[model samples]
Target: MRIDAAIDAFVRQLTVDRGLSEQTARAYRGDLVDLAAFAEEAGVTEAEAIDLELLRDWQWHVSDRLAKSSLARRTAAVRGFTAWLARTGAAAGDAGARLRAPKSDKHLPRVLDRSQLDVLFARLEGRAAGDDPVAIRDLAIVELLYASAIRVSELVGLELGDVDRTRLMVRVLGKGGKERVVPFGVPAARALDRYLGAGRPALLRDGIDALLLDTLFLGARGAPLTARTVYQLVASLLADLPGSGPAGPHTFRHTAATHLLDGGADLRAVQELLGHASLATTQIYTHVSAERLKAAYATAHPRA
Candidate 1:
């Protein structure tokens, strides 16, 4: 089969069979598309024509253009693609069986202190006490994100029925379509109640898009809230905050996780709350907690 068409089928299978998120599937597809282009240039127009050398060449081509993390992802993508091709009888062998990329450096996720969160929430609440529907929605967004520690995609994907207001929890379909329930605090519940009672209705219109109508979060035009819009809201909130890493919606996720750890929450419990597939993935917050403890010791202990 042609490389591009094979990639298309593989991506479809990733979404439908593997239960991968659309974002993850698209990323894999993009990496495979880049590989297909390089393979075509190397006269490997068909999946059967691809070889280990072509995979290596594609890695070399991207070495100067992409970061190590991106390179690693591309390598992993191609490896999976070739494995799928071979297993499905589309390729003679797994061309990327031996492909390797430099390990991506692991950096600690950025977290906000309680004081910083206090300031942010106060500001959001102050603005939400306005006549603007968007501002109120933004406040609710902040409350929900920090309270639940959900991904932006998951937050935007919330439907009206997904949240159990009386229970103070939300049911999220996380990566790989795994459904998990996450609890929020009373503050988040109050914000959501206010949004549903007044803000959402003000922004919504009669005969609004069905997605928007069912969605808990809506845009200014009453359309479904997008991940990009959530990112922008978070970026604007973090624009002036002191931070090193990205100030996107994930910052809140990191902060929520760290704060939970700081509050004596169990590691395993937090893993469930964050919907992490592996405990190892959730262990990063332990490092953040240790670092915080060391910093607190350094600040309070005057001994040299």
Candidate 2:
């Protein structure tokens, strides 16, 4: 089979059978497409022609151009593709079974301190106090993001029915199509109430369709909110802050999880709250909490 055709089949199986998210499947496809181009350059366009040597050569060619984490992801992508091809009888053997990439460097995710969070919320609240619908919506977006610790994709994917205002709970469809309920604080509930009651109505255009009406958050043009817009909203909000890492919505997620741990929330409970598939994925916050504690001890300790 052709490498491109094999990659398409593999991605389809990933999404349809394995239940991977569209974003993940797209990443797999992109990595495989790059591999296919490389294979073509080496006169090995057929899936059956792939070999360990060819895979290693391709990795060497791209090693200097890509970051370690991206290289790791590409290696995993190709390994999955080759394994699938072998299992489906499209290839002679799994060419990437022995392929390896360097482990990605682990940097603790950027987390905001309580004072920083307070300043951020105060700014948002000041803007929301005015009658501007977009400002109100922005306030609600940041509030719910920090309160619920949801992925930006999950946040924007929410529908109107997904939230239970009375209970202060939200139902989110997480990675691998898993659905979980997450609770938010009263502050988030109040912000959501304001957005739903006033902000959303003002943003909705006349003669809107039913699908958009069901969407929980709307853009300035009354369309469903997108992940890019959410990122921009968060980036602009965090630009003037004193921190030194990414200023996207995931920073809110990391901050929320770290704060939860710092306040003595159970590890397993936080895992479920964040809709993590594994407890190991949630343990990173514990490291963040410990680092914060060490920092506090170093600054306040009087003894040498």
What lDDT would candidate 2 get against the real structure? 0.94
TM accuracy, model 2: 0.98
lDDT of 2 by residue, 1-304 (tens): 8889888899999999999988899999999999999999999989999999999999999999999999999999999999998999999888899999999999899999999999999999999998999999999999999999999999999999999998999999999899999999999999999999999999999988976899999999999999999999999989999978788999999999999999989999999989888899999999989998999988999871
The per-candidate count of clashes, in order, stands at 0, 0
- In candidate 2, how many Å is residue 39 off? 0.8
Off by over 4 Å in 1: none
Q: Each candidate's lDDT (Cα)? A: 0.91, 0.94
- The segments of candidate 2 whose C-alpha lies over 4 angstroms from its true place after superposition are none
